[model samples]
Target: MTTFRKIAALAVAAVMTISMGACGNTGSSAADTQDLVVARSLETTDMLPQTGFSNGDIWAIQQVYQTLTRNKTDGSGVEPGLATSWKQSKDGLSWTFNLRRGVKFHNGRTMTAKDVKFSLDFARTARDDKPWQFLFTAIRNVEIVDDYTVRLDLNEPWAPLPSDLSMSASSIMPADFGGKTETEFRNNPVGTGPYKLGEWKKGDYIKFVRNPDYWETGKPKLNSVTFKYVSDANTRSQMVQSGQAQIDEFPTAVSVSSLKKTRNVHVESFPSTSLIWVNLNNRRKPLNDVHVRRAMAYAIDKEAIVRAIYYGQAEKANSMLSKNLMGYSKDVKDLEYDMAKAKEELAKSSAPKHFSLTVQVQSGDPEKSMLAQILQESWKELGIDVQLQTLDSTTVYSNRTAGDFDVAMFEMTNDISDPDEWMQYMFSSSANVNSGYRNEKVDALIKRAAADSNQANRLKDYAEVQQIIADEAPEIPLVYKPGLFAVRDQVKDFTVTTLGEYKLADTTIARE
Candidate 1:
């Protein structure tokens, strides 16, 4: 069997064992009642903060580790996390953070400024090709000012530095935990978060127990949390419906509707910064033609996808940036879904008709599959033979990075509150090797916005950038789906942020 298949088999077996145990149990202990059981769509392969690239990895890391700052539950602002207070230099080149005293790691080690320095340095110099590595490139040096204070000297003024520091990739670890390999770190992670690693059964479930000495007193009300990996959407929904699981992440749209009506099941949806779209390979033929790319944009019925597939749980995306974000432009309108306009645009291209193209999508996501079918049907009407190919996430990402596919359906969420986080990596000529499309003007605007500390100027630059991208159509913006979480009605205070990060420390399980 393939490695993934084997892992899935083992996961199913482990879940069966747990389900049987739960079924056989009598209501005797408070520990059993207080534990929050959640169903996740994927298995977490790594625990190292900087190395994680998937939602599963982030979900695991956020619970075990702590960043200097974190976005508020509403994602409206930032709040103190490990660092109680911080200050930035007038020029914005230097930032100093005052660490929280008496903070203890999972291993009972005291967290200090030195640990913060070590973690930042490690993330900055990581050899792996982590997506967040570029965010740390501006850091000139990390100085341990004292036991409770550390300062970062930046190469240039970066307005989003504080928000960037709040990313999961910037999670602080113990000073002595630096030299361990990725496997070693994943096996035993040490962090200052409210939950500590309890037990990990690979491809099955990861159990986490509350940290008694958590920095925040009287917090983390739940005694334990068990994240069960169940990739199938229907199975995950069934687990929650049968009371086998208390929470389920990324529940299918169909499941969501039914779960909302089910008694004792509470469904919560947050406006996510997540953008779902088709990343066209601009280096390939037809796609490379701006007219053809525009044609594809005009052909897509984004509102229809949002309504039919997402069940009105999502909003049609007009530009690369989501409306919830800072730099999103209401001024730049989406290309209307007009078949006549699409045909006209295509006629202007070198290869006007009889062009065949393969669109790639990840296999498991029902929403993406539906989108692929919709696109196939729409493009087919335009005399284009569109082939839908489904592959695993790893292969799809690899293919995207290598520019091996004609068009790939992908979703990306902004880790920070700034426009630079999304724009630079996705659009900048020097950075976007994935799309392999470069426009000098777009690159210049991104750079200008990145450096300009003035909010108004940065907004103006980003608006222009969005206008250009909308016109050029490197990516066909489809929809922004809300981050959906279904939890038991008894599970209180559990919230998912716009960035899709969960805050579980304040959650509590009410006794029946």
Candidate 2:
């Protein structure tokens, strides 16, 4: 059987299996229990705060851990998290955060300034493989001012320091936690959040139980939360439709339409800072040529893809920064889809007339597969042969990090409310996810934006950076896809934030 046929068969099998399970559980009492099961696409065995790179792992960490500050779901402001309040020095080089008193970790240890110092220091010095290490690079030193106060001194005036502290990777851990190695910490994670780690069964589900001594009283309405690893989109949707799972993340467009017809399911869509794009390996042959990269960018029909594949659920993106972000420029325009322009640019390149290239997509993602097929057809019109390669999420991420692909489909959420979080991580020459693309001018602009204390100066620097990136076309900006989730009707007060976080502390189940 061909690739398309094989994918179709797997999807059909998944739907049938879920349907059978739903039928068998019609009379079961699982729904009446206080536990809520959420189905997501990826499985992660490692739970270390600094090592989480995927959406699933980060989402899980948000529930089990607490950061110093929390970005508002709407992306308009920041709220207090583990820190009750904070102040900055006159020079903007030092920050002092006041810890919440009586906060207890999962292991029954009181969280103090010592734990805050340890967490920030660990984040700044973590291994290079961790993508979040750059977020803490500005910190020069972390000092425990007292039992409830900690100070961070930076090498320069980093304007987004507080926002950076809001990330899940900066979650506070026990200062004397007995974790000999990274693997040990992964196996037994501890935090001072509303929930505590309960059990983790690889390939199945990870469970978290409510913390009775949680700092916030009367929160974490649900007694327990279980995150089930369901890689198949069809199966994940079926699980929710059959009432087997209370929530599902990243549901397919088809599933969203079908679930709307059901009485007990609610499909919610929120504008997100997530950017899905086609990453071009700038160091690879043919792709290294600027003309070839521009040709590929002109060939993509982003509007059509957003319409047909996402069912008009997303907006066409023009740059790495989304419109909702702080530094997004309205002047940057998307390259129009024109086959004639694509051919013209290709003719000017030093690439062979006929060459085969591979585009990698995550396995079990129907939307990405459709996108790859669309690109394949478009590139064929320009006399380029394109191959679609489906790999698991882990392998796909690894290849992209190792610069082992000609082209790949990837997505990332803005780490914080600042443009520096998106631009620096995705386009900086020294960034791990740069995809072999580097420009000295772009790097300098990013640095200027991060260090500038003036708001207008920072915005001007970011705008220039976006213009340069648009001209070079390092990646084909696809769409600003909205974060969609399917929730059972009985699940009350549940919401998925624009930052791609699930607010479950106040979520409750309404019993019929």
Best by lDDT: 2
TM-score of 1: 0.89
Least accurate 10 contiguous residues by lDDT in model 1: 21-30
Write the residue-wise lDDT of candidate 1 on 61-135 in tens digits: 999999999987666667898999999899889999998899998777899988999899988884645766777
Give the C-alpha lDDT of model 2. 0.81
Model 2: per-residue Cα lDDT over 1-512, one tens digit each: 14334444544544455344342222124446678889888776567888787777888998888899998989866789999999989998999999999999888788999889888888889686687888888899999889999999999989888888888889898874544465667787889888888999977889999998898989888899999998778778778877788887888764576667656777988878888888998888888888898888898888777766776788888887887889889898667788788889899998738778999989878778877888888888788999999998878877876788999987777867778778877889876475678899999899888988898999999988888888778888899888888888778888767787788899887763
Count of backbone collisions in candidate 1:
0
Segments of candidate 2 deviating more than 4 angstroms: 1-31
lDDT of 2 at 365: 81
Model 2, position 258: C-alpha lDDT score: 68
